[model samples]
Target: MLRIGLVGIGFMGRVHMLSFTDKPMIPNAYVKNGKLVAVCDIDSKKLEQAKKEIPSLEIFSDYKEMLASGKVDAVIIATPHYLHPLMGIEALKNKIPVLIEKPVGVFTKNVFELNEVASQNPDVVFGLLFNQRTNPFFVKAKEIIDNDGIGKLKRMNWMITNWYRPQKYYDNGSWRGTWAGEGGGVLMNQAPHQIDLWQWLCGMPTKVRAYCKFGKNRNVEVETDVTAYVEYPDGGSGVFVTSTHDAPGTNRLELIGNNGKIVIENEILSYKKLLVPENKLNETATANLMDPKNAPQFEEVIYTKKELGDIPWGVEHAITIENWINTIEGKEELIAPGIEGVKALELINSMLLSTFLDKEIELPIDSNKYYEELMKKCEKSEFKDTWRV
Candidate 1:
């Protein structure tokens, strides 16, 4: 069996642990050749609680000790945002297979360093817990886009505000909304999945100009609301907007191309396929007074993928874990490789950098300069309860 170790016993760690159990949420998933052999957390009380829930489970207060004891064949780093890269690099250097949690890291420089260590250990498997990649709707979207179904993208817009968090949520954790701790607000936590999906489906933009509001409605130092405009190299453009304060929030993505359009919202994927490509009609139109307004009508198809379950987060995460196990056994390929984690991080940093400098930021950003800017913010960080535990 693939003896797996899980680091971090907080919210995500608990969610990861449940996927390994006989929970009904993941009825279709199980690690056939692997099991959770050990768990590590800095919080002793959390470790104690974990032992109560998992009687036969091994526990560790220090991750390094667990790594050195050779108790686990692989590990899942589910710690906070800042710990992903640090713990990932340590696990990779030890020649241990690792599946790191999202955004890879708060910044590109650190994630790049972790990736360098992973590259050095080619045999060791590396994956990221970008579980949303397993969602059928997103999978279908990627297939359609890759097949040129949308043909020469012109514009894309995604306004995802379903991530609503109250002041109490941030008040409970001192590190929740600070630059020195969580790195960012909505972009880092609530929107990593959307950000990753954005690049995964639409590709990274060439430049980004963003406006962000810090502590807009919440009592936090990082951005709680953001609106960003992006440009692609092929002249295509996009608009992204998100907020944690909008109730009855919206989660919609619309993609327009020369041939057709796609709109995904409320777990449904709809497409409008053009009979004659727009560009072709634009060039060969016979009428001088009017544009080509006639095109074959297409029906809207709803894609529920009921087999994937109604609650996507838990189900998709379970699928990701199963895929990771099979990949380690040479049975399948990873849907979300850890290295691709940098793409979303770059997008996050770019948007935030644009907000900080009040101008458009270019892609493949200057990592050192961003890091320098971040450290300056870190120095002046004024979060009162900055996570002493």
Candidate 2:
């Protein structure tokens, strides 16, 4: 059985703990080689409190102690956004795998650097908690998109704003808002999932044009609203609008193809699929597209939509964790591995860069240069992550 430790005792750390318990629940706790062996935090009171709940576990004020103790096989990092890269890099350097919370780093350069570090330590498995990728709805969306639900993808409209955060939510921590601290607002923190989905389902656009407003409707340092137009090759395109200030919020994704359009709202995937020709003999390309002998055919493919509505937070954590566990046991593949997450990170970073620079930025962004640029305007920040209840 692989023993594991968790660092950070904030809201996300607790969520990580809860997700570990949700696995099977056969023994009402983590098992199958995965156990919460140790925990660490600077706050003695908080660490002590956590120890009581997790009896038989060890606690430490310094994360280095936990690593040096060598009592576990892996670590889960649920610390603040800025600390992700540092902690993650430290753990990998120690030869311990890590399952870090979202937005891997404050900037994409950090993510790429982290990836390089992980590559140096192939014995360790670095992962991101991109739990949403495991959700049935999204998994199905990817499958359909890969199979071509829409003919020659034409347009996409994504209107997602159900992630409204109150000022108190930001005010709870002095470091919440500020270009230097939390690293941009909604897009970096709350919207990584949507951003990941945008990239996952539609892939990164060759070019992006955007307009963003920082604290226009709220008192946060980073942008609260954004509208962007993304241009892709294959004559396909998309328009994206995201915010954390909309009232009676909504999460909707609309994809239009030459044949049909698909809408995913209310967590339900409703579609008007265009048909494709049946009985085509081509193996690789649609027989009609590849050969004149096989003219383009038209037949609609229906997806048996799963019953999904109002998904709970961290719903897919268990799936991600279980996959990691299985991978360690040589039973399956890693879920949301670190390298793939870098792609998601770049997409988000570019969106922010485009909005900030008022110009399009290409994919696989230069994180080091971007970080340098970010520092020029951001000078410094104040969010040290108090881990508000």
Candidate 3:
């Protein structure tokens, strides 16, 4: 059995721990050939609670000690946003397989460093917990896209404002909305999964121009609302609008391509496949806009959750964790490799950088410049390290 060590007993940490248990917190979500052998957290109260929940569990106050103790064959870092890369780097250097929670790091620079270390430690499995990748709707969307069902993507738009958070939520944790602690508001915290999925399905954009509102309808220092415009390499453009302020919010993704259109909303995937390519129709139409021949025919298909079976919340996290363990055992390849985590991070940083500079920022942004700006925000953050414990 793979002995796993988990760091950070925060909300996500606790959830991850449940996956390795004999009975998972979520239905049909238990892992095989792995068990959480040890847990590390700086919070004494949290550790005490964990010890009570897990009998005969090895606990540590320092993650480095946990890594060096030889009690765990692998480690999972579910710490704060900024600590992800740092902890991942340490684990990789120790030649321990690691699975890190999302957003990789606050900035691409640090994540790049982590990626470099992971590259050097080729044998060690480096996985990322991008659980939403396992969602059937998204999985189907990817399959359709890869199969050229939506030939030559022309445009994409995601209005994912369903991540509503109240002021009390941010107020509960000192690090929740701060630059030094959480790194970003919606982009870093609530929307990383969708942002990762955006790139995963639609591919990375070449340029990004964004408008962000900090503390909009919320008392957070980081952006709570954002509207970003992006340009793909093929001259295609897309828009990403997100906020934690919308109530009964909207979660819709629409993609328009040369051959068809795809939409995912309310857990349903809708595809309108055109009988003739739009470009071809545009070039060969026999009549004016009112002509019957000019009107394109579409074969629409809708995929629903009922057809796919109801996937319980938090089950995807367990699936990802199990995939990580399987990868470590050479039983399966990782669904979300840790290195690909950088793409989503780059998108997050680019959108924030665009808003910061009030211009369209290019992909593979100047990491140094973004880091410099991020540090400025970190320097001004009022959050104290003591508050974390």
TM-scores for all predictions: 0.93, 0.86, 0.96
Candidate 2 structure quality by residue, lDDT tens digits, 50-156: 77777778898888788879897888888778788888889999988888888887787777778889889987888888888877677777777787766567898
Q: Tens digits of per-residue lDDT for model 1 on 258-298?
A: 88888989878887777767666744344444543543434
Please report the TM-score between candidate 1 and the true structure: 0.93
- Answer with 1 or 2, whichever has the higher lDDT: 1
lDDT of 2: 0.74
Give candidate 2's error at residue 314 in angstroms: 3.0
Candidate 1 vs 2: which has more TM-score: 1
Note the Cα lDDT for every prediction shown.
0.85, 0.74, 0.90
Ranking by TM-score: 3, 1, 2
Report the candidate with higher lDDT, 1 versus 3.
3
RMSD list, candidates in order: 2.6, 6.0, 1.9
Q: Which candidate is the best by lDDT?
A: 3
lDDT of 3: 0.90
Q: Sorted on lDDT, highest at the top, how do the candidates line up?
A: 3, 1, 2
What would the TM-score be for candidate 2 when compared with the true structure?
A: 0.86
lDDT of 3 by residue, 268-360 (tens): 989999997777676556556678766787899989997665666788888889889999999999999999999999999998999888888
- Using TM-score as the measure, which candidate wins? 3
RMSD of 1: 2.6
Q: How many backbone clashes does candidate 2 have?
A: 12
